[model samples]
Target: MATIKITTESVAALTKSAVPNKTTFYFDNELAGFGLYRTTTGTGTYFAEFRPVAGGSKKRLKLGRVGTLKANEAREAARRAIANAALGKDLAQNRSDERASLTVEELVSKYIEEYVAEHKKASTAGLYRMLLKKHVKPRLGSIKATSLTRVDVQRAHALMTREARVSANRAIKLLSAAYGWGSRHGHVQEGMNPASGIKLNEEEGRERFLTTAEMLAIGNAMIEAETIGLPVDAGTTKHAPKGQLVVMSPYATAAIRLLMLTGARLREILNLRWSEVDLERGVLRLPDSKTGKKTVFLPTAAVDIIKGLTKLGSYMIAGESAGTKHEKPRSDLKRPWAAICKRAGVNGVRIHDLRHTFASTGVGDQMGLPVIGTLLGHADPSTTQRYAHLADEAARRAVEAIGGKIAAAMNGGK
Candidate 1:
């Protein structure tokens, strides 16, 4: 090692020279222990040599590559390393410890494999995986799990809210759950959930209930889609295949009917197996649902719809390849639903609103809230209370009926 003034020009001149088969070290004459090493291949690296403890062994810390870092920039880093080393701090070991720490990405993988996949429902597990992939992992994956702060979570939540508020809320909750699970299982430090207590974006409740007239229109549209095929949208058919029409599959049509009549969730109907459906007993025994092992009682109309559908392998709502070696449940009824809604002239109503419609219809017919709650498979009675206004309307009708009967009897006696 030779003591020389380390500058950009000096390092450049050394790197440009083709010094073969020998590595040379040049220490800064002005700053002790701060230097650069030029290899036999003409590449250079900046390093700082210091005694980690007073009068103890010397340790070397690599600052950066020659061209990637300026001489002044590297000197400043070396100054900090040397200053920390004088105070008995091992900067090199600190960097190595940071590199070896568990990151948020690894924690998510561990949580998914150990807890989510094992304990959560398949549908829930799938949703959690999607949210983590699309939102959580991309934003915070590289962050060290132990050092994650609530501010970091707040910033991510704020950014995610711009695209999807509901999904943002759910994603944060999922992340919080992962952290809690990690803490319990020793993967994370206790009480260190950065995602906890975030002020989530306000999401409006979607409580659309179809009127009786709308239900009749939808029923008519279903009939047309099943048989003659509903009219295609002229706007969508600009590059049409001659005289193409939108005809829903029989299985899809039945799925919609089941959704309308039984108030079952979309997945519950789509994944319904023949073994779970007992038409004779008028119930669908779902082995696993969002609520776990639920039984949906089918009314006469719902039972008739299921009875009419052909049993294609296991699933009642079969895909096109049902009964084949590649048989599986239909993924979704998005196209069929769009056609039906378009023909019915329904606007801004989701498939989930069909469930609201079923509950509203029951409430309108004077079925008590408890009865409606049981039919909808609501674990909490409060979940069924959204239709309390409709129940109030039913009560008003019953009171009017009693009053009219008493008045009529009194007049006849007169």
Candidate 2:
């Protein structure tokens, strides 16, 4: 060990200093616990050395490499580190603890690996991963989980809300789930969820039903996009990689049509298997659904559409490519649906709204609430209550008919 007063001058000279056979250390005369070391391979780093006040083994905490950290900054860091050591803190252990505290990015990654990969379906997990990469990770990933505050969460959610309210709500919901999972599983501190109590933006559930004209426009646009390419905004101020040509996908077309014809969840449609569809019975027996195993009766129109399609091994709407992860059924509906809507001038409607319209049209026809529930595969009665107004109108008509007959009887009696 060489004793030297560590100054800018001293550190500058030490940059060229390295031992041929072994590692060497230079002790700082002014700072007791501070020093610089150089390896035989010419790797130089600054470190702070201290023994615990409670009488333990000597601990060394690495500050940074030469040229990366200035001598003064390293010395100041070392000073603080040594003071903490004298106060019964283990600098090395503290460092280890800090590293162990997961950042938001790390938390989501771990969540995807541990919980999602094991528990969720591939399609479901893929959506979570997509949100993490595109939304959560980019915005709040670098922030440590323990360091996250309510304000930080609110700000992040607010920013996303400005971009897209529905997307913002979904992202926040997923974020909350992730935070809860992390906390429960010890990825974050117990009983600490910064996302807790952060009020989510009110997302009005859409019940937009496409009118006859709108439907015709949409159908025509789908044809146009499938035949030629649909012109899309491509999400750019400049040029986009995929260009303005959003070539429509046949699978997406089928998916959208099926959604319109049969009121089913998007995932149910995307993950529909050949085994599930009972052509003879004119129904689908989905063993897995948003609620549970459900029997979605196929209308003659929906069944005809299904019959018109070519068989694509195991799935009604199989993905393109013979062998790949995405080679199953369709997994997404963003681009094709966007093209259809944009070209057709049918804006402010989501794929889920197609399901809503199915129920809406059913209600208009005075379909029983229980029957509609069965059709939509709603596990809860409350789920069907959103369309209760249809039942109300039917009840009103029945009452009027009964009252009119009673009035006629009274007039005849008089």
What lDDT tens digits, residue by residue, belong to model 2 across residues 1-414? 999998889888877655546788989999998998888888778889999899968988787777767889889989989999899877677655754777988887887878888988765788788888877887899998778888998999888887778777777777888877775444565456788788888766667778878889989988887777665573211234455665565767888888998998888888888778888899989987877688888889888878877776677786765245556666678877876887788989999889888888887777789989888988898989998987798778877878988988989944
Q: List clash counts for every candidate, in order.
A: 0, 0
Give lDDT: candidate 1, residue 364. Answer: 95
For model 1, residues 276-320, the per-residue Cα lDDT tens digits are: 998898999998887777999998998888888887787888887
lDDT of 1: 0.84
Cα lDDT, all candidates: 0.84, 0.80
lDDT of 2: 0.80
Q: Once superposed on the true structure, which residue ranges of model 2 sit more than 4 Å away at CA?
A: 1-101, 121-123, 219-251, 322-326, 342-345, 401-414
- In model 2, the Cα lDDT at residue 68 comes to 61
Name the top lDDT candidate: 1
> Residue 393 lDDT in model 1?
96
The TM-score measured for candidate 2 stands at 0.65
- After aligning candidate 2 to the native by TM-score, how far in Å is the CA of 375 from where it should be? 0.4
